[model samples]
Target chain A: MREAYHDQLGELAEQLASMCGMVGDAMELATKALLDTDLAVAERVISDDAKIDDARARTEEDAYSLLALQAPVATDLRTVLSVIHAAESIERMGDLALHVAKAARRRHPQPVLPEAVRGYFAEMGRIAVDLARKAEQVIRTQDIDLARVLDDEDDAMDDLHRHLFSVIMAKDWEHGVPAAVDITLLGRFYERFGDHAVSVAKRTVFVVTGKMPGYSSDATDL
Target chain B: MREAYHDQLGELAEQLASMCGMVGDAMELATKALLDTDLAVAERVISDDAKIDDARARTEEDAYSLLALQAPVATDLRTVLSVIHAAESIERMGDLALHVAKAARRRHPQPVLPEAVRGYFAEMGRIAVDLARKAEQVIRTQDIDLARVLDDEDDAMDDLHRHLFSVIMAKDWEHGVPAAVDITLLGRFYERFGDHAVSVAKRTVFVVTGKMPGYSSDATDL
Candidate 1:
């Protein structure tokens, strides 16, 4: 029974890593579709959302079955709980991507954003994808080093967010408004994506160290 | 053991209801601050986020303890799961409210919306508060009647959102970009508040009925 339990746990973690990869790829595609005014890719991103929804449902089911069938405890329990939360966050991130894609489809052929705001969006997209990748990395390798770096990764996303706001509010404000709103929503999505990724890392921390991360209310502050 | 289990469940339900009430009040204050342009009240709303954060943490702790201690099954397990997800949606709704309150504070003496835009804002605000209150009703009563109608309630919010967008874009194109970016942000917040409130209602439906309201996802439609 113990061996079976370990095997099940290993399988679930691998599946979770794959889901993160797929969701991250979807987000990258959605971002490109938005920036390049690529209707075909925009349509493709939106059309392919079922992939995300299916993965999300499966992830939730895996966690539930692990809890009910295997009755995971201690580290295993943390993994399941964190999986549930992370799955929800990734699904929502997918939705955000789909949202941007639909908007892109609607406003086809629009010019790319002005430079300052464009930089913010690109940086946000990169950080979001990296955070998702790092989550999978920590999961596969159980790397304490990767877990420790998550906060710094999230901080960078936040810095980009604050800068996007400042640029919008500056003298070039009008130049940034449309791009700013788009960037703001993108930042919110990416920041939140980074946050959920951190939750996975913290769960790793807890599993490896038997300590819940600090902060009484650190849900998605991840 | 069963009686103690019942007692713990009751406590959890009560706490969830309390959290729901706070979220409802947060939505109320968000719109009220907008309508009145009361920066002090908005500041208060932002400052008081800790209360909502505390409630969220307590809800999670209670849910986790209930599951780990009681080892509930079937319907009981669903009940715990519902509480966990509801608290999550509530946390996000609080964050949405904070987003609006923060925007309001930034626009101290909030920029006056056009009369037409104000009317739309009022309509959106009313619908948001109504949906939030209905969430409380479902939590307290487990009223499937009320819970299912959330689709309709959300339709109203969606309608208001669509109407607001038309005005914003049309005015921008015709009259050349009038309202402050802050108002735009406020509108986005209210729209999102309604979305999360509907999410809470959907969770209620799952808890009570054991079915995940299978509204097929087109992702393109989002």
Candidate 2:
């Protein structure tokens, strides 16, 4: 009973990791859609929402079955519960990516943001994909150390976020109303996207360490 | 053992409900700030983020400790996890409230949205408060019927959201771009706030039903 339970539980774990992998891929596509003004990619991400929704359901079911049948105790039970909660977090991340994708669609042929500021978004996209991939690695290998490093990556994205904001604010006064609104909304969404990735990282730490945040509880000190 | 667990878990449930109540209050003040151009209220919501963050943390710790201590099964386990998850969602709702607050701060007092449209935001706020209150009542009484009704409230919010967009698009084409961007972002954040409230309602269903959305088997949807 124990072995069979562990096997199904492991299967659930692998499924979650793969879901992370898909979000990583989706993030890549989202950024590419932004850069290339590719409607196809944006549409794909939009349609993929149902897919993420489905994964969430399955993980919840798997978690339930494991608990009901195996009746695990102590640390093992915490681990299972953590993974289930973590799955929900990742689903939200995917949902946010789709929101970004929809934003991309709304912004057809993509007006160019200031070049210096554009670099910040590029860096944010990079950090996001890395965070997603790191989340996958953390789940598959249960690597706490790598998850800790993802912690710093969140800060880097945050810096980029602040930088983008200051630049946009400086431009807002000069560029008039339309520019101000665009920069504000764009920067806002980008900053929030970084927040979602950080959330995924936080959940990864929780799953591996049985702690809300592995090393630092205050990831949003900025 | 079961009785002792219930006592501990009951407190957690109350905290979860309290968190939602706080979010609902913040949302009400945020909409008032936006509609009335009350910078003070906007500033209040921004400063109130720490309170929301604290609520989220305290509620989360409560849920985690219950799971760590009680060894709850089936519905009980689901309830604990769902509350933990709902706290996170409620926190996000607070974040959206802050989003509107920031947008309000950026705008000058003059040139408010039309009366009919402002009514939509007001209605949205009331519905949000209602759904949140319903969820809280369900947690308090374990009334599945109340939870079920809140679940339906999500569809209502979706419909209202569509109306919001059309209203904005109509005014934009009709009134021209004068004050368009601010109104657009305001509408956007209001819709998002409603969406998060719907998410909390969905978790309430999870707590009661043990049915997690069941979207697809092969999709790995997340």
Candidate 3:
């Protein structure tokens, strides 16, 4: 029975890793769609989101079943809980990508981003993908050091977001309200995607160390 | 021992309701600060958010403790899960309110909403308060009917969001990029606040009926 429970736990980790891959793919494709103004790619990203949501729902059900039947305690319980949190975070990332895709679709035939801000978005997209990839690695390996730096990695995205704001708020800014709105929302979507990626990493750290990030030094091990 | 667990569950419900109340108050005050350009109120909203975060953390600790010690099953388990989800949704609502406050603070001494869009924000604020209040009541009463109708209530907020977009996209719009960015972010904050409220209500409904809001008739009850 114990072996079965451990096996299920392994399966849970695999599911989360799979979700990370899917979300990473979604973000990459969505960013491409945004940068290229490709309606087909954007539509694909939007439609592909259902797979991510379904994966989350299934993982959550697995978690609920494990909690009910196995009644995991201590680190086992935290592992399961962290898996659930990670799944949810990944799903939110998928949703953010979907939002980006929708924004791209909305501005089809005309790129949503003005040329001046496109490089910033390209860098933001690169940072988001890097974060998602690192998030996947942390979940799979439970590397505390990797998890520790995920937040610092997120700072790059934040700086990019702030830079995007400066571009929009520049005195010589020429884009009207519609383009400004698109740029602002796009910046936010990328920044928040980074946040959820960091959250997944932090939750993994909590599972391994039994210490929540930014909390007290005390470990709340069960 | 069973009675003690039941009591803990009751306390969890109360904590969630309290969070709902605090979040509603935060939304109201933040909107007031934004509309009136009141720096003091904005600061208050920003400072008060920590209290809400502490409350949610305490409530979540209580939940983790209960799950660890009590090993609840079936409907009891579902109830605990719902409480946790509600707490998270309410916390996100508080964060949304915080964003509004921050936006107001960023634009301080200058009103964030242009005159033409103020009415839409006013109505959005009212809807947010109403939804938060209803969310509190639903948690307190477990009123399935009330929970079911919360999504419909969200429609009004969505309509207001769309109307605000129309105002932003109007051909004669005079607001510069900064104002447009502020309005776009502000509108999204309110819209997402409404979404989280509806999610809390939907989770409540699921707790009551063992049915997900949009899922098929398959009953996954334990």
Candidate 4:
């Protein structure tokens, strides 16, 4: 029974890694769609979200099944629950990517980002993909150290978000209200994408350390 | 042992309902602070979030302890896990409220929402409280009917969110880039608060119906 349970856990981990990869690809494609104004790429990202959703659903079902069948305790219990948590974070990341794609698609051949802030969006996209990839590695290996390092990456995204705001608010700002609205929402999407990756990484750390963050830590603080 | 486990589940439900109330109050106060430029109220909202976090932590710990001690299966397992899920959604609502508070604080004395848009924000705040109250009742009563109705409430929020974007994008929009940015983020925070409430309600529906939402259903669609 124990061997069978461990096998199920191994399967869960594989599903998790796959989810991370799918989310990473979704964000990357969504970014490409935004930067290149490629409707096909944006369509792909929107259509591909179903796969990420399915992956998350499968992971959750497996976790619930394991809990019911194996009734695993202590670290094992935490592992199953953490898998659910991480999958949820990754799913939200996929959703954020989809939002970016929708924004790109909404603009169609016209660029979603203003020319002045495209560079900031590009850097945000790059950081988001990097964090998603790192989240995958952390999940695959359960590397607490790598998971901890995601905080710094998330901080970088925050910095970029702040920079985007500064550009919009600059004295020489040329973009009108519509462009500012797009930039604001796009920056938020990218920032939240990074946030969900950090959330997954933090839960990975919790699963390994068995220490939940204290009440003092804000949800986004993770 | 079964009776004791059932009692624990009942206690968990109470904690979740209380959390709903706390988060609802936080958002209400945060909205007031934002609209009124009341710093003291904003500070209270920020400080009170710790209580919501603590409640969530305690509920999770109890759920974990129940799973380990009782090894609940089938319905019992789903019930405990749903409690945890509802608590998590409520915790996130609290975090969104905290973000609203911080936004209010960041702009101190200067209102976050411009005078022209204050009415729209007021409506959003009113709807948020209404949804939170309904979520609490759903948790307490486990009313699948009530749970299903949250979707419509959530839709109302989405409409408000769309209206906010239109307002921001209107050619007549006079708010500068900074105000626009703040309004955009604030609208998102309120929309997300409604989203989380709907999530909790959907889980409640799932627990009662033993059915999951179809893949085509959007997250906000719930």
For every model in order, what is the number of clashing pairs? 0, 4, 0, 0
Task: Kindly report which residue pairs in candidate 2 clash with one another.
Answer: A51-B221, A52-B221, A52-B222, A55-B221
Better of 1 and 4 by lDDT: 4
What is the CA-based DockQ of model 1? 0.29
Return the TM-score for candidate 2, rounded to 2 decimals: 0.75
lDDT of 3 by residue, B107-177 (tens): 77878888989999999999999999998998899898897677777887887888888788788888777
Give the per-residue lDDT of model 2 (tens digit) for A89-144.
77867766776677678767754354545676677888888888887887788777
Best by TM-score: 4
Q: Is candidate 2 or candidate 4 better by TM-score?
A: 4
What candidate 3 gets wrong by more than 4 Å, as runs, is: A215-222, B215-222
State the lDDT of candidate 2 residue by residue for B30-112, as single tens digits.
77887898989888988998898898988876776777667677788777777877787788777777776676676647535
For model 2, the docking class works out as: incorrect
Per residue, candidate 3 scores C-alpha lDDT tens digits across A148-217 of 6778878877877888898898999887778888888888888889989888888888888888888221
- TM-score per prediction, in order, is 0.89, 0.75, 0.95, 0.95
* Reference-based lDDT, each prediction: 0.72, 0.69, 0.85, 0.85
Please rank every candidate by TM-score, starting with the best.
4, 3, 1, 2
Candidate 4, residues B1-222, lDDT tens digits: the string is 989987888888888888999998999999999999999999999899889989998999999999999999997788788877788889989999999999999888788888888998999999998899999998889897887787787788888888888888898888877788788878888998998888887777777777754322234311
DockQ of each: 0.29, 0.20, 0.41, 0.54
| Per-residue lDDT of model 1, residues A1-222, tens digit only | 779877877777787778778767877887788667788988888888889889888878867876777666556666677777767766776777777677677767874466557767777878878887887788788887788787688878777776766676576466534554455555556666677777777776776777867722123211
Model 2 stretches astray by more than 4 angstroms: A1-12, A104-121, A162-189, A207-222, B1-11, B33-55, B68-70, B98-123, B141-186, B206-222
Against the true structure, candidate 3 reaches a TM-score of 0.95
Ranked by DockQ, the better of candidates 2 and 4 is 4
In order of lDDT, best first, we have 3, 4, 1, 2
What is the DockQ ranking, best to worst? 4, 3, 1, 2
TM-score, A chain, model 2: 0.87
